[model samples]
Target: MIRLVCSIVAIVLCVWKVFNWAWWKPRRLERYFRKQGIRGPPYRLIHGNVAENGAASLEAKAKPMNGFTHSIVPRVLPFLHQTVQKYGNLSIFWVGGNPRVDIMNPDLVRDVLLNKFGYFTKMKPNPVVKLFVTGLVSYNGGKWSKHRKIINPAFHHEKLKLMMPAFYTSCGELISRWNKLALEGSFELDIAPELQSLTEDVISRTLFGRNYQVGRQIFELQTEQQDLLFQSSQFAYIPGQETTATLLLWTIVLLSMHQEWQEHAREEVLRAFEKNQPDFDGLSHLKLMSMILYEVLRLYPPFPLLTRFTSKKAKLGEITFPQGVQVGLPILLIHHDRDLWGEDVGEFNPTRFSGGISKATKNKVSYFPFGWGPQICIGLQFALIEVKIALTMILQRFYFKLSPTYVHAPHAVLTLQPQHGAPIVFCKR
Candidate 1:
């Protein structure tokens, strides 16, 4: 009899644990949000919105958009886009059982990112995802502060000036390859892989002080790890490599599509350097190129969504978020918002940044391509310098136009990337 009783007790406990974890807890959170007047998609049991999210993603990916367009909302983020349209910007949503509040308001995004209080902390990515990459971007509090301090010197203006030779060398290699490919006047080539290699080479050399041949193993591992993360439904960052590569690809694509802007940027590059190798000072003087890069970054930010968790109960603007609620700052949505960026939000006009970032956007937080405030990208200066040098060198050697076979599909895995690789016809200048 006692044995039977013990078996019954074990079964009851297992059932209760499963119920609490899968149903009870999620329902309680749903009730809390509802009570607070926050609306979201009606939560389904166990999986919540995960199944729906996956389905929507599959559908979006299957259908690629036509032509060169900056509006990636429908293709890359259909679920969130639909949610905001139906429920509103500040609505709550589910990622599995976890209740996540989507904050579209720039004020709340600023508050969350700035993170003055210790209450808001980064959402710990899944352990498998964490294994892929972890840097200062993954840290919090004192650890983050320490890492930032140590890394700051590497990206300083003086340090970047020293690294210009490394940039020039890596870009020179790319130029040589492109020249060979374009020997018969013009030739079609997929620039995405080339740019990826170039950026990886730049990072290997500049950051680790190793040549591409020596650092090739590290880059390959990182690429493999990113591919693994991309296959997983759980969102996680692969850090610098993909983001930098994606940015370069988009910048090239945008420039190719807008021939006038491409010519203008090339002119700026030539005028700045005057047939000399691009130095940090001369590259900085290329205002037109700077404007073009800024505009490209605005349209396609590396990390589309930035997530934080409430450690303790906290108030953001008017709403009070309970402890453990995930808060998502949709960076892509903010960057492309027509109200914030005017009617030309979807259009690529580098002149928008002619007066610089501060004068370009309606609000300070609206234009956070590299993120904002204390947690702004540490490698910002380094990345920009590399881009400037590569672009300067390319403009000097060749001009490129979109190949007829090129498909314009921008999607986000860890970062925004062309769904079909960026194929361009490169011609000797």
Candidate 2:
């Protein structure tokens, strides 16, 4: 009996090894990259580059990062930016033994996102992520189209205009609280949770037409999901599929960091209102809110990375990708890539988007904060207005700065977030 058990164990180990070598080798797609004359660090077996990527992420999170030098994309994918630096525009990397080709050329991106989106769909997702976030952000093909159509009206200009009052109310409450704090002398508040509460309030009131109680629950659940996902350390998950996890990572991180921006935005809202005395309906008509929406989406996109999968044989630009290969859009990487956005690519310059997104990049496929093509974010306009109304009202009264206890460590746990907490000081203006 002991010998029988030992034999079974031996057989299982051998079979697993064979499968890893023959089917799941990280370099299975090496030939595809080689055909395109792209070079990359040699792929590691089974683990590929994921272990090193994880280590590098830990290192980045251990210290404060200079905005220009702090690379959120490379931290998530590791060795990818270095590969691009060495291999030029097109390159390949692995995500846990899965081959994902990274294409930075705007023309190639345009071809894939615009001309041939049907050929690529969302990456094969983890079963766990498919549970929580089952919204349009994760859908593809016909299902994607249907969801997009249904969600479109939520973001219509008229609908957004109606939602403007909710934004003002939430922001007003925050400012009023700060006013009381200022009167009491030293009031140290953590801005991370505060802004989160603010955004939650907006999403709740506008999305569900109630207070932020439900949105707050969703946000708290998402925080738990973030922790669970990190323990799993798996990517290529479905949208809103992670149950308690979230898909909007980058926006959270940036809002946590730019405390001063919050203050400036509040001032802008007040100034606009004072100059025009726009009521809720009138405030919705304010152009400054529109500009702020564009700027924030550009600077701090919620989902920084977009992943797609190829089924059957498909041609993307000069390279032909055989079925079963995953492609990463690296939206944030493209947004900040110096080649696409001049030397100030890494700089937080909202002026670049002053003329609107289409004009921002000359119709290039680089600046898709809510994604593009048929697979574009269904809630793009909804998310933006939710943010806009929230910011406008908050800015009406308070000044923000980095909290004294704030630690500058941003990490990706589903979405980018402050590893410690978003410690921000709110001053009543």
Best by TM-score: 1
Q: Candidate 2 at 285: error in angstroms?
A: 5.9
Runs with alpha carbons beyond 4 Å of true place in candidate 1: 1-10, 217-238
Model 1: weakest 10-residue lDDT segment is 228-237
Task: Please tell me which predicted candidate would have the highest lDDT against the true structure.
Answer: 1
lDDT values of the candidates? 0.80, 0.60
Backbone clashes, each candidate: 0, 14
In terms of lDDT, the poorest run of 10 residues in model 2 is: 235-244
Candidate 2 residues 1-429, lDDT tens each? 999999999999999887876455545467656867866666776676677667776765665655423445555444566677787777777666677778888777877777464787776457886654555555667765665666667677777678777766776776677778789544666555666566566656765466677644544455554653321211112232221112222333344356555445556666667533245454555554465455545544556666778876788767888888777777667876777778876555556776877888988888776668765655555555455554554455445555557665555566555577665555555
- Candidate 2 global TM-score: 0.78
Error of 1 at 206 (Å): 1.7
- RMSD in angstroms, candidate 1? 4.3
Candidate 1 residues 1-429, lDDT tens each? 999999999999999989997889889888888887788888888888888888898899898686677788878888988998898778877887889999888888889888888778877778885776576766778867766776677667788788877888888889888778877898888888888788878776875577766765554455555643232211112466667787888988988999999999888877777678887777778888888999889888888888888999998887888898899888888888887889999999889998888888755688787778888877777778778888888888888899999988888876888888889988898
